[model samples]
Target: MIIVSASDDNFVPGLLNLLYSTLFHNKDAEFYIIDAGLSNANIDLIVNFSNRNKIQSHILLADKSQLDRLPENPYWTSAMYARLLIPQLLPQHSRAIYIDADATVVSDLSELWTMPLDGNLLAGVLDGSVHQEELDHVGMGNDEYINSGVLVFDLALWREEKTAEQVVQYLLRNRELIFPDQSAINATVKGRVKFLDRRWNFFSWKYPEIPAITPTIIHYTGDNKPWKKRRAPLAAIYEAYRKLSGSDFPRPRDLPEFTKARRTVVGLFSLRPKYWKIVYYTARCRSKFTTPHIRQVMARASQLDQAHPRKP
Candidate 1:
């Protein structure tokens, strides 16, 4: 199987961690990363990751300027649209899987890879948030809408139907209304998508019950990304793989520079009890809030032993 993903420099760490988790549970595949101005250092890390793990990985060079001509959509960066070029670029591959960088594969991906497209151009999980909007946008029924987060594309069908071209043209016509490439994809391929189990692209925010045993892919579809926020549920799961993988370049907090600075200001001066206690303690100790204060406890015990000299 061939797995495809796209990311810009900002998402390199998350993307690497995503792949590390995937490689942990699956086998015999070539991974493709669609590069959107990834720095040399980051690219080297990714390249070394595949080499170290002995996995076949390729970094497909994407022309970032291509999307610059398209109408800007604030909801998502143009990097997200890079996947649209995959089928055409890698024409040798008959089928492919495209997962967002914000997601981790907690279970074996083989099941999703084997899911038959059944002549459909693509297969994906439903996006209820944009269901009505997508349906209304594309003039399709509510049931026809699917999220592009975790997509299983039938390359042959896509190439034959010129799905990418159609999606781009649709985006141009509906430029004002569409704010995401995902909505555009669904609108263009409305009737041709087969909806899969939600677990395939189980969004962390949408479903309150996340880390559900059934979810093969856990998507961090909200602002509380595991790396940025303090207490996001399922953060431990992401941290597990994050620690297992490299972390040379960590993702900054998911805030604008001004917003992040403002939060830091408040955190530094807030008089609310326990407001900065956790931050200060964690900074001094460098351990999780749940961890025992072993170092301090052991030091106190040592002092007591020295002062009370047992004669025995």
Candidate 2:
């Protein structure tokens, strides 16, 4: 299968871990790494890893001029917009799977690869944090929004429909979108998107009352990155992949000690007005709505890590 992902030097470590975890499950998968301003040293490391593993890998340099034209925010870089060039970049491929660098595959991807698109241009999981305001901002309904982190692109259809051009134009016109690429794609594609099961692109922060199945892919969304904060939710799973990938990246050490009252205050202040209602509900139901399922999922991940036994 053709698997595509984009990254720059800052995210190379996460990219390495993602590659290692994916290869562990899908050994024969081909990789297309979009080089969004990766340094020579970082490129060498990726090339060396691919060579040592004897995997089919290609690193394509992103078009800097095109990337510069896209809107960017403090949280997301121009690299996020590079996925828009996928259909153009890989004209030879009929279909491809695009996964974000901030995610790890825990199950075999062949299931996802072989799934029929049923005429949809793209397939992805719904964004857990999607708000009505975000959808309205992009002129889309709440149900139409999907996370761009994990996607199944029908490249043939994308090329035929000029989806790349449409999305780019939408983004250029709607610079105020909170999620530039995601919102643009949602608005542009509209009815052509296929919603997948939540387990496909499960956010690490979401703790369901009763998880029916283990997540096939774990995505570290938002600001609590495992590399920058040691105590981030589900960080051990990410750490396992990092160790398995043989990455010597330094561990995060400066974990701040926040008092309970201070943490509560900070969390309340950090939330947007739209989310205050949910927080209020959560506060009232904390005793009845505890997240023991998260601990169970973490334990399962820990067991899997132990079974794989990474070499030091």
Candidate 3:
């Protein structure tokens, strides 16, 4: 079964639309919605939407305290890790695939679901971009971290391993500085993860680096999301979500400096090699300019609203 474990707060209606799209395109799969910390009213909205659409999938709800025994933090939540202990929660199920709310399936997930666990605790892609910093910051061995954004877990073994307990213990022992849940996962699983292809947990920044594969799932794992108009390289996934949602989530406008600089650099880099570094540096500078800075200076700016809502 393919499962999406999420709370009402992090949950978006668009996510259900994405699930509907996947079910429409692929009929052989079952989706489980594990609703953590949602009111019965909100749960009914989800269930009614599924019923109206004639979508058949299990919809389960639990309070946060019921879902996890440990205290919550920004890095780890009951919804995110519940699937890891799926065997204990739903002991009949021997395996399951976990997806983040900020993702969509482009291809059939059956292949991903069927991936050989090979006695490993988990199977997922390492965030290649963050590998070095993670290793240094946490003192982990090279390439030890795996992005929790997409995980194909062996539920039985994960329960046998008591991974959630280990993760919570790590957090307790470390004095509460774990910023990303992946850090605790890396510490517990250590050398036991089966590295999957980059296509599974494909992030936005690396989209330019690899040729596009019709991925089983596409993850919007960075600040530049498809909800914005500024170039998010892997925006087709969001576009797909937008189509399913029928919501006018307009893409934001571009900053002139970044736009002008990106164009100038791409044009220059497309030319002779000797000037490549100069043009590259200029492009980098443009990319680094903040939207707030642009908004502060430009009177006519519209498209550059903060990707994340500003804190109160």
In model 1, the runs with Cα more than 4 Å from the true position are 131-135, 140-142, 210-213, 249-312
**TM-scores, one per candidate:** 0.76, 0.82, 0.70
- Candidate 3 lDDT by residue in tens digits, 1-312: 556545454455445645665664466666777666667776776666666555576766554564465546664456664554445566677777777766766556777788798999888987765645556766775466778878877877878777777776775665444444567777778788999887777765554333433345667665555554445654644554454434334545665477767776776768956457554543543344223223332322122224322222
Summed over model 2, clashes come to 0
* TM-score pick, better of 1 and 2: 2
lDDT of each residue in 1-312, candidate 2, tens digit only: 899999998788778778877886787789999999899999999987776545578999899999998887777789999899899999999999999988877778998999999999999998857777887787666566899999999999999989999999998888888888888998888898889988889887763321444577888888767887776656666777676566757678964667854666666688855457546544433323224433444565578667865433
Candidate models: Cα lDDT each: 0.73, 0.80, 0.61
lDDT of model 3, residue 197: 80
Cα lDDT over the full model 2 = 0.80
Model 3 per-residue lDDT at 57: 67
Clashing residue pairs found in predicted model 2: none
Which candidate leads the pack in lDDT?
A: 2
* Order of the predicted models by TM-score, top scorer first: 2, 1, 3
Task: For residues 34-87, write the lDDT of model 1, one tens digit per residue.
Answer: 987788988898888767655578999887777776778776778878988998
